[model samples]
Target: MLIRLIYASRAKSLGPMDVKDILESSRRNNTAAGVTGALCLSNGVFLQCLEGDRVVVNALYHRILLDPRHDNPAILDFEEIIHRQFGAWSMGLVSTVADNQALFLKYSTGAQFDPYQMRPQALRAFFTELMGNTRWLA
Candidate 1:
């Protein structure tokens, strides 16, 4: 079954080189594991959308959580979906670092604080952005 593992985390450092190295390993592992998705780093936050079977997705999720490169990780999105929204991306879409203004607007939602908190507004905005941008990984 196809599922998406969407997560965002605060980076330990904001250096571009640091971000590159941190993401490279995850990107390579996803490819090797036959997982398709996208990874985006912006404003010290690393966001990724991954797709694959139950085992691969779960394993990848666990690996990310344990990776100490990021601290106080927050999983912004995660759930089982009936369709694949990021079928085009090999690792789907890695977003560039968003500016402070953009980041503020993105996370300005009034949803609940918990990661697993289900809020329609926040979820809608995220998926809408992901769906609207066809060239996410470009």
Candidate 2:
């Protein structure tokens, strides 16, 4: 069965090259595993959605949880889905190069980047908006 796993984590010292490296690595790994997702890094937080087989997505999430590049990893939404929202991407990414604060404010109530406080549907909506936004196109 297919599943969608959404999680948020604090961002580390993620520079341009670091973001590039992450995107490349994720693209490669996820493509091989038949996973597709979009990753958004904004205001010191990362919001990502992984869609694939339950076992593969679960394993990938576990590896992500162990990665030391970020901390405070929290799973926001995890459920079986009939279709992939991010089917066009192996691992599409949006980093903090743009105005992250504004982006966060656009989707959230406050200026702070506390995605864990958002309701599941709201978070998914935010992800959908981000995925469709031209600025976040990858």
Model 2 global lDDT (CA atoms, 0 to 1): 0.83
Candidate lDDT values, in order: 0.60, 0.83
Number of colliding residue pairs in each model: 10, 0
Looking at model 2, the pairs that clash are none
Q: Which ten residues in a row have the lowest lDDT in candidate 2?
A: 95-104
Give Cα distance to truth, residue 83, candidate 2, Å: 0.4
Model 1: residues with Cα > 4 Å off, grouped in runs = 92-107, 110-121, 134-137
- Per-residue error (Å), model 1, residue 121: 5.3
**Candidate that would win on lDDT:** 2
Tens digit of per-residue lDDT, candidate 2, span 4-101: 99999997766767777888899999999999998887767888899999999999999988877888998999998999998989998765655445
Segments of candidate 2 deviating more than 4 angstroms: 97-103
Q: Compared with the true structure, what per-residue lDDT tens digits does model 1 show for residues 57-119? A: 988788778776787766666677787766654554445434223433454443312323435
lDDT of 2 at 17: 76
